[model samples]
Target: MSDDEFTPRLGKSKGEDGKRLVKYGGRVLAAARLAGSKTGVLTRRFDGSRIGRGASIGRLLSSRDRLAGFRARRAIVKTRLVRMAGNGFAAARAHLRYIQRDGVTREGAPGALYGRETDLADGKEFLERCRDDRHQFRFIVSAEDGAEYPDLKPYIRRLMAQAEHDLGTRLDWVAVDHFNTDQPHTHVMLRGVDDRGKNLVIAREYIAHGFRERAAELATLDLGPRTDREIQQRLRRDVEQERLTAIDRRLLRRMDAARITSPAHNDPFQQAVATGRLRKLGAMGLAANLGAGRWRLADGLEDTLRRMGERGDIIRLMQRELTARRLERAPADRVIEGELNAPIIGRVIQRGFSDEHRDRHYLIVDGIDGRVHHLDIGRAAATEPTPEGAIVRIAPRSASARDVDRTIAEIARENGGRYSVALHLRHDPSASQAFAETHVRRLEAMRRAGAVERLSDGGWDIAADHVERAAAFETRQLRDRPVAIEMLSAAPLERLHGADAATWLDHAIASSEPLVLRDAGFGRDLRDALAARRQWLVEQELAEAEGGGVRMKRNAIALLQRRELLRVAGEIGSELGKDYVEAADGARIEGRLTRRLELTSGRHALVERSREFTLVPWRPVMERHVGKPVAGIMRSEGIHWQLGRGRGGPQIS
Candidate 1:
């Protein structure tokens, strides 16, 4: 017989020559030995004894209770699966950048600290291998400090190995250890596919309960059971924590008559600890004694504590920033909260992450008020980069309707309760044409939002409460533009000396308003800069030394502004390879959008016209229309953009 004869002869089992098999025959063969383990099934022992009919029910209940207890005890790992959608190339780049952000590792370094099951250096290539993968995984895992003896990377690797075994396939994953916060944790980015190259769907229970329990089990095995002294110490620390402490959680669980009663655990040490915590809370005004076994908890206790905790963090941040700069603030000027009575005029000193995990940002400004203010600006993307040394105005943010709404209402009232571009011009013939067009754009925006109705003849039906409606609209948009930043001057302080521009320093010197000078950080620096600027002006013949004081030219502000515009135009001209063309006030600008440049004033967009080009205030809409034609009316203040070629097309600010 040949080797092929040893192989079983193949037959059509589904055909008439063979017997039929039961449905799910493969499952039966695979789980034949575990048939008795199914729910609601009773098992018989070899001793001719049978377990109770409710045995499986009890088992199910026990398993659920165990999981619930594990979660309550905080003996579980934190794991998340962040999906990577859209273009594979963009996702790959973003993922790598995110994991490599500052302060990501235990050593306070950039990039991941560990890689599991594969080489860490080949992260890009690993990402490329799954370029066609529809969804990728970024799993974050954190374990309790139970196993403090071993390195976090090896423990994480063991967990991943266990996962591979349970899933019956190999996995490709990379991990990073972050110790920047109180919690020491690891971030694991795993490919969504299995070894055979198919989408791997993990069961929700496995992700939620199984992974955590497995990690906990391995940690417990390595470190042994937690000592009583450690457990008590943890509880003691929790009692004094500001943000949602464990004691508060326990009180919530055992509340009666709006108060927490002592537990009847019969453990004297635990009972004494609970009573001591109650007494501490009473002293802090968070709890009060009502009787032998009752207490009165403060209203909104949790919220107040959480706010205090946040303020504490803010204080710590302020101190750190000041220390790093080798600066100090008076105790009264150290902390600032709520709205400000007056705007703080200052130079930006530094920018940093306020809540690093959430990407919230903060700016450290050296104010002329003789103090450094830490301003928490909401998000990073919406914030314009106000580079260090740029003077800025930090006012209490107000989200109210501006004068534009009032102007619109007055124009409409004069036009028989109807507002149109032509009617606006007729109402205010003295107003600049571009300015009149802005009111029309405002009306168009209101009409689109359904706050005002547009008539068939290109006029708006102005209501008596039109101003109120517009105010409501502005309030609704406040969430995105939380702060309104007014640019004083776009030129850097260093270039203000002998520069062909009327910079902020020049404006400060020429204006009648008093300059609030302080002998402090940035303020002292500004004083020296202004003195040097005067000398530079005298040397350039723009100023003359008269009676021991410098006097500027009569049209110095205007001349400097013009010279600066020409200098900026020259720079843009070189970049675009076209001549500079200045657009007169109210002139129509039609061109293809080029690129946006960030200057001291704000963002500006270069518009490439036929043989010449110009720079105008950049609008968000122009970003999407880059390389496409854009038409707008340029005013002294800003441009009122027509989105398309047609006059009746949509307009944007």
Candidate 2:
């Protein structure tokens, strides 16, 4: 690839002849997967030129006649490429792969550009030459970040111009207008022949191989006494040094003036809209707000606001909530006042929450004393308040229920029928029995081998032989299991006295379904993915390393699943674990532990890792819960969720 691949689009529209004018909107979508010919089963074509959407870009320019002639010339070149090669996706992929490998034409075909086709006769000859080519190649180059992101495009353009200058020819830009995804990528196409039908040769894998060195080389150079003031100077000098054309300068100026449109700092919509304003509208907002400050408010945003009576910057969220509604949800034709959420309650609504985050179903209460509180809707929905016995933990997914019941029963027996025993009334009786079986096997072996004795009341009376047997069993199991499987094998057990599965969770971080981050800009996709993964990590009680930044240890994950530990390495507070994982991708499926046993040292014996496909570093958490949350501890406010009329973030620890 010269510096990029050729991803050209051919379109046309009526020249404001106002009558059915059409023009080409250029660009194509491209994806590449090497070794595997098929992109995936969902893909429509094998050779790979599939245009899912055919809305042409030429329609806009048809409404403006001034740019017609220039567009026509470009359209002609595009048509020729379409005839000889494939559609945008295939051509773009081929071009990108070719450029990276340094595409160079040998004998046949007119070069990607055609200045020599001055006459109809020569153009016909040129088309013939292009059609006869036998070999095709690919190249790829990417700015590890993105071309449109902070200070990257200018650097890339310089590289392209250098390649063009070195080859003594203008590089054909084919993939510039690819429309679908905002990858900030491009493809340039070329042939061995130049405008004169002479031979052309270009380097291969040039982008990654060449630019890798180039980026480093540029990183050096003591631009001396660097400071914030010097940054602008360097940028200006770089643009000028590369001899940017007047058109390029105009584009950069327009981009520099663009504004963003969201609460998130790196909003993709802001970026996408800037591109549209640049390509279609010609200009955008003034410089975007980078510093911490207020957003110019829109209308109709007050419907969601309510005072939580906590202390933080959330007081200002009401204004933003109102503004967003006016911009996105309110009927555009109707002019409205402060949004529905903006109450007269003298506080700034600064907590930026979504409509869903704010849209909670209220309990619809009739309160005395003229006061109202939302109360936890989830808990209220599932639980009935009663003047009854206290709540306790249950472990049915574990085998401990049986052992626990036995312990309680024996205690009762020893007391000679004092108080009735009820250990977590809801856990299935079978699960409790299963838990006892696991412990019983080890105990029976020790007694039979003359190493220990079982008390008449079912307690262990052990000796050295019993200890020796446990040590042997644990060592054998560890040696047999691969490191990763052994790490993820045990499932965490949580004993919730009377609480159902749903009520015991940290509702903010735990959910049954997946979600997509929504945004008009492309970042919405990434944001959602990150949020879900982050939630999972948090629920697993896995926090990033503390001050020392230790690599999360594997053993900690096992301990958490075993429910023997709660808090991971550096986080505060221990917690009960409710975790489950497959031993390997194709290994035996993991069923809920209807038969339970305490997950402790020497357990996890049944998890099997296949002889092949070694498990890599699997995702797991290390949590050690000493006991449930201390009463009155402020709830976590990290998650933005709704409970009745209220919306709040989990309080930070």
Candidate 3:
């Protein structure tokens, strides 16, 4: 190999002459020694080798000083990694779209996406080529002085070179520079395969510790170690920062159990910075002078500062999303957060990852409350896909099992600690076959999950505390589903008026719930929609003008809802190239999964049972079983899939 080509130097070794070769700074030294030092006392004050105690202390202090400066500059660069697990190519595409989103440059231009081998403008073909890779890796690197440079491509290239040198192989990667935020950052994506066509596995320590250290080293090389003046200036500025800062971290660490902070015990410079921070915190009611150079900290000081920092981040996200959409909101409106007690009915303005590094998601909704709300909706897969302009209602999801759990337990108690579809139908003969089957499906799901015991006869031996166990099971599953989403209308509000189907506007007007419309943007638009629908109702002769108010005919709402369902069914049937088939109460349905279709009423799954098919309420579980055979009983609410993996055939009612 040429001198310029990289080589891996693992360790020292012995030659044929029995000489020890020690590796230092990538060079092998044979029997190396301190050339100028005396045998016992050592003459040189300091050299590249260890000698006397005085020289050792001096060298130690020198190394620490250099390290201190390095650490101070390291804080300026942020490094993060995102692992693309399943459908890596799809993830690669999604990440490219996100990083290259419009207005992500300093000049408000669309981010120019580029990879090592291909420009992002032709990203589709490049991603298709990468489809066979097991996984992809996305990395983000941002420098504190990144904005100082007109373009960040050179710095990114330098960083990647450093990575290649450290990783001991040529890497396959792509990158895009994003400059919209305060920090100009680069998004780098790497194919998971290495130069030898083998899976590239990076150590967790290397990702967490090594990558940032190298990035910081490169940054320091470019920008130079921060001067004492620069460091002091930053420390002074941190005194008044509203969010968590280095000063706050220090204070939290140094405070006594009595809630008192005494910076006098620290270095003179740190004492001054801490005093200034305490004064600033005092102004914010987070600190108080306890006399004698000590200050009393507020209870939950760290938590309060963290929350404030989070709120600031949320505001920035809301503003960035709004600006990208060319929309604006009033500054006076506080961003809603945490668990909401009631559902927010609105049209989805946009949906995207909130924390891309963590795969957490968020939504921007134009709510009926007259405000554009930003909601952090946890994982993206927990909720169904909602296209922009789709009307949806978002409610806080509960971990506890529903009343259905209690109903199943009662049925099991009546049937000798067991429950089955046949037994359920015999006991509740008046109940719709679909409804009874729904209970059986619930039991089947619980049994499959090992939350409840299932007998060989397709029945559950549910205990009195089955609901509690179900809730515990849900909690153990994951904290990914924080919000329950229901699609109210797949079509936009403007297109719903004058249509021959029922719309959300009609229900809002005729329902007993108070019409609380916000008089801004989408809220005002919805108000206009409600008025227009009222007029349409009169024109359709569904209601008559009575004493300055329109009087709807008896069961008009029910009639309109039925009409909407039939119209949706007709459209679905047209899509499937077959007639709409409604499953009878006791009818059994079995078929290969087709696809899921969204309608005005709700989302439905099309199950083709050999030339004929029926639309059933779509369940999330069915997504994995698509294009595979499924068996279930048609129940009142929906079809229950026969997920046969247990003792008796796993069937849903």
Best candidate, lDDT-wise? 3
lDDT tens per residue, model 3, 280-382: 9999999998888889899998889888887788777778767887766787653556666788988898887766665678887888887878788876645
What candidate 2 gets wrong by more than 4 Å, as runs, is 1-130, 133-141, 144-158, 177-183, 195-199, 205-208, 211-653
lDDT of 2 by residue, 1-653 (tens): 56478678755554556575432221111233344455444743453222111112122223232332211111101111222343334333333333233222232222332122221123234334555443222222333234233433344355445545444565433322121222333233444344455444333223213333333223222122235444334333433221222223233433322332323325454334333322321221222344443222112111111221121122223224446543222222121211122111011111111111111111211111111111111211112221111111111121122333344334334444321112212223543432433344444443444544555444444332333445544444333211111111121212221111222122222334422323422124223434443444445555343453222334434444434322121121111222333243223332221111223221221111222111112111101111112111111221111111111211111
| TM-score (all chains, Cα) for each model | 0.66, 0.17, 0.69
Q: Which segments of model 1 are wrong by more than 4 Å?
A: 1-227, 260-276, 289-295, 349-361, 379-382, 406-418, 440-468, 487-500, 517-519, 544-551, 561-590, 599-603, 609-624, 631-645, 650-653
Please report, as a residue range, the 10-residue window in candidate 3 with the lowest summed lDDT: 25-34
Q: For model 2, what is the error of residue 458's alpha carbon versus the real structure, in angstroms, after optimal superposition?
A: 86
Question: Alpha carbon lDDT of residue 387, candidate 1?
Answer: 70
What TM-score would you give candidate 2 relative to the actual structure? Answer: 0.17
Q: Locate the minimum summed-lDDT window of 10 residues in model 1.
A: 48-57
Best by TM-score: 3
Q: What is the C-alpha RMSD of each candidate to the true structure, in Å?
A: 11.8, 30.4, 10.9
Name the lDDT value of residue 128 in candidate 2. 43
| Residue 324, model 3: Cα distance from true site in angstroms | 7.1
Question: Could you tell which candidate, 2 or 3, scores higher by TM-score?
Answer: 3
Residue 541 local lDDT, model 2:
53
